[model samples]
Target: MAVRQRVVAGDEVTHVVLDREWKVIAPIEDYLEYLRQEQYSPHTVRSYAGGLASWWTLLEQRGQDWRHVGVDDLARFARRLRDRGSDPTVLALRPSKPAATSTVGSAVTAVLGFYRYHAIVGGVPAARQFYVHVTGGTMQSRSQYASFLGHIGGGQDRRVIGRRRGPSTPAPLLSPQQIAVIKDDAARFEDGNWLGDLRFRLLWSLLEETGVRIAEALLMRHRDWQPGTGTTAFIEVEPREDLRRRLRVKNQHFRRIYVGDELDDLYGEYLFLLAEHGFQFDDDDPIFINFYRGQIGRPLRAETVYDWIEGFKRRHPLLPAEWTPHWFRHFHATALLLAGIPPHVVQRRLGHQDINTLMRTYAHVTDDAEMRAAADWKMLIQRWGAAA
Candidate 1:
């Protein structure tokens, strides 16, 4: 099955999956339409469509009907998805890299949601078999009385095929030295093109300073920047649309993050370079635009950033091969937490809605900080006893 994008009424886009004969798969299309009606983001609908297409492909290979599948079928499908890149026929002792657990989990979640929707609306009994209801403190119970809402309906039904998520690992960080190297490399004049170099430097600096998401950085407009007195500037990250892509800020919330004088100076230099190149931008114009690539003056796309990261990796083999622009944001958040910034304050700065999310993502950092504090406390006690 193949996924296709279609623009519906009101200029909204949606996705549907097609079979071998190029006919739209009715059930999948129905579920996708439901998602659209529920106002799910286009990206999410597209992802769910892709996941459903994969499931359909698996069913076709087994000659099994979607409505007749059981829990065992889903388990097998999950395993297949997890082991996507590994060739079972290969004889090598070292196994090929498998898909990330989160990727497999997303696909599984899409499939499960599809089945659940069909079970409720289309009366498919197979979907009902995938979930079981639990009460009290059984081994399979997922209830928690920690929160007020959890106490209301904590022992609700649980999916039998769901993957139990483990504690989140510490977010990968870019060391200050590595960030310095990257910014320095980006600032170098490439082919004696100062404009291009300045643009990249500003981009990297903005990300490092504000810790904004790549989408937020790309979607920012000049008007969103408030240049205050010397050494004090702020970027207002608001929900805005891009002319070239359907990118939107996560959580769709407005936040203002402070930037250092260094980044503000970089921005000034970038604007000066832009003026010299006769590319004047209005206040409403995107801050990060394509100055040297396709359709100059158009807002920069996220794909281009990824491409740049790949090229940077090639040029500097010492840098992490898997590094992306997101590492800057992670580095920023970790730095704030380690520097004694409160979790709630960091949450707002990073545009995270929940304080628990900040805590969970950087739990390792907090744990390490606590251990070090304990060591310092012990030393303080020892010194006090010696003085006495």
Candidate 2:
């Protein structure tokens, strides 16, 4: 875990909230501190920390030793994990079992992360060393391993270690009502203690309406959104040329979408406030500005979004549990597809690289549609047989 996030872009990034989301460079303690400094929503931090803690305890139990680990040791560790009745091959949830292979894979990757950090501070080993050797890690798993190591330096050297395979699975979705409740707080925030939070309403709203990622939402710039000529207004988002680049879109493809009246009106009102107070809408200006201290022209950063969401959760102590931005993504896609939107169209809207991703994530939701298609084919076959 790291404390200070790397500066959005800098030579030396002190552990800050931004660093928490951008870089995974800090030690667990610093990462934890950075999480606090960045005001990471308690629940988000808790979820990440809970996973990290499981990793940390496993490390301590294994004797925080990082200097020497080979593939054999890693394989042995995986075997040991399986022997202990941990989830053998599961990716996320396995409350019923000790843990699954996917989680075991995660634990292994976490250990590998520790060593990679050590290598950064201590220098690389003389020979190619294996921090985590997976019996089942194909090229696909290797890519996922790369994702986990994305935050650490020289992590690229670590071969991404998963099997080349199909899409894994979607995380569970928060109920629509639950999302509505969170949105309710956001709606009330038009006049809440946290004035900066008014953005949450728009932010959460956008995530639900479209399957945009948190980083994508935070990167929204004045120039990215285009109000079309007709009654149909669309916002054009292209992938940010650089991930570190602020106010940039996620994917590179030009995705033009119809911005519903609700969002358009809210965006209009926000910009009006900026104009009334003498704010400049420069070409490089970010759309979501931070008004916490009533400072004009201060754009909202990514960490600020997370912090705000967590804080919004604070207003409702009576609520059962807190939520994160990703949940909105799940809710958005699942709700739309279940409502009968075609998977391909949903994939395009969600900006997934493939239609299979949409189907795999919402397998339970899409199952019925597939069933209906199957029935139609079956009836057509029967009719053809009768004609013959």
Candidate 3:
């Protein structure tokens, strides 16, 4: 259960495990290797590994062996997860409240996945026995049976995982007023500190205007910026890997976002400043660099951006709790939807492969639109009747 940090080759740091007693309960190393082989992101690998650790710790407390675990054991673990606040390891750090449903579900799913993997590879038949074979003419008929891992059935149904959890609370977006205030504050930078100011302003404007995720924006390279046919410029978001930096896109989907002449001009200034700072202009040089004292010209990292936001919050005590870069994305999406742009177009603009995802996330906007349409239709009928 001990989390240890190790420096791998090329001076890169990776979160690795220390030899702990919990390894007896689970093949932690092997599972992590398997995930690595499957190209799972480092974040995902850490999460799954942590889930397995928590499961093993809980089972150890209950004096139960994973090989002999049953459905009842998993149910009890789920109950414990729902009742406990925070991660099991960090429970003593703060007062415990019930964990969120999504968190509980993920823990359960992780445990189930572990067992399923071990059941097939470790030759433990009891692991497969933990699932209850769902049957009958109900909607589950297509499923061979329900196991903790997922549904097991014939054809495509076989080896499917558990049902996905329902949507949680909607993510909050920044009001236009709030955004304007933030922009005004950022604009206060003068002669001595213009670099940081311009960089942040352009970053915020790009997020507000184009709605690309922060990661997508940060990973952009000089060559990714293209000159459009007219006065506009475009930023291409491509799934890329930087092994030294341990950076990559989430889903590897390619999409283009067009920027107006103003943003393009702002970027041109930023590029000029970057060159003045002695940064490289190579094709692969990150458009956004870490301007902090020692790391100039190096690519920016997530932690730095987070720290910047946190510092801004400290400066503006009245800033909303939900005011983050992601909130800007939500604001952009809602603005587009309410502006009468087709949902499909907005989906493509946002680089969402699934329209259902777009609709579900912004259902509130669409619901309001539907209500307005309904009112207009009612008014039309009433006017026609009066004329008759």
Candidate 4:
């Protein structure tokens, strides 16, 4: 089996899974269409398509039917994913490292969701084995709160038999010095491409200051930037499309991020440079576009940004090998939290739909601050006792 991208309408793209004869798998396609109808993001649908494709391939290898899969079969599939990898057909010449716990969990979750959807709609039997029902339990006995409509089901509950996930790791942060090094590196004019260098610097500056996702930044237009009266400015992030590429803002919400004079100055400089190169942009034009390579005046792709970071890493061996552009985002949020910004405010800035998500993600930062406060309290008490 294989996954293929299909363009629907004019610019919108979706994914489909194909069998050996290159025919679309009906059940998977139906489920994916249901997701699109429910307004799920295209990126999310693509990921689910890949997971379902892998599951189907595994089923084919074992000569098993989707309607007949049991909990044991799912368990074996999970083991295979953890041991070998996502692609069931490709065997490594040497023992490869297992997939990450989160990857395995996502793959299994996708398969479970596929079966669950089919079970609810088409009365598939396989999904029955994936969930267990509980009818009687006190509110205190329950691990999670029921949904608002959950009481309609006669107080019954269904829970997936899922694998235990590992502990949440703290989000990685870049020090101020490291950020400075990166920005300085990006600002250097290589191959006499001064415009490209300036654009790179501005991109890094925007990400570091706003904490917006790479996609949001890439999809920004000239109209979204609003300069303030003095040493302040604002950048608006909203649901928009890039005509040249399939780019979108993730949350589909309007957000305005506050910025200082430095970034505003950088923006002005970049625009001036663009005009000097005889490239005039309208208000709705993309702010970050390719000037030096690959279809000039088009919005930059996420893959190209990743490639640039990889090349940067290779050139600068002293920098952290694992640092990506997203690290700038983590550093932004962590710095704000450390500086006593409210969690809700940070949540809004980062475009998270829920406050609990922001809290959970940065719980470690708060935990570390509490520990430091306790140490300081102990030191103060000891100092007072000695004086007395």
**Model 4, global lDDT:** 0.80
> Against the true structure, candidate 2 has what lDDT?
0.59
Off by over 4 Å in 4: 1-10, 85-95, 133-158, 188-196, 230-232, 241-246, 378-388
Looking at model 4, which ten-residue stretch has the lowest summed lDDT?
Answer: 139-148
Best by lDDT: 4
Model 4 TM-score is 0.85
Q: In angstroms, what RMSD does candidate 4 have relative to the true structure?
A: 4.7
Off by over 4 Å in 1: 1-14, 85-97, 134-154, 165-169, 188-196, 229-232, 241-246, 377-388
Error of 3 at 334 (Å): 1.3
Q: What value does the lDDT take at residue 337 in candidate 1?
A: 86
Question: Which lDDT values do the candidates have, in the order given?
Answer: 0.79, 0.59, 0.71, 0.80
lDDT of 2 by residue, 1-388 (tens): 2232333335222223222234442455454555556554433444444445554434445565434546655565555554553433445463443446655665565455545544554464411454332333322232233233443633344443442233456556677677677767765534533344446777777787777877677767887766545686667666653233233343355676677877777677667667766877875788777765545566666767767666766877655455677888888888887788877888888788778767777887778666876789878799899999
| Per-residue lDDT over 1-388 for candidate 4, one digit per residue giving the tens place of the 0 to 100 score | 5555565766667889897678899999999999889777787788888888888888877778878988777887887778764444456677678888888887787888798788778888777667655556532232333332455865744545566678899988789998887788788555854523888889988999999888899988999998766646899998875533666688678889989887897898888898987887999988988877898987788878888899888888988899988888999999998998988899999999999888888899888877887888778899899999
Over 275-343, each residue of candidate 3 has an lDDT whose tens digit, in order, gives 776876788888778776447667887677778788888888887854778899999999999999999
Assess every candidate by TM-score. 0.82, 0.57, 0.81, 0.85
- What is candidate 1's TM-score against the reference? 0.82
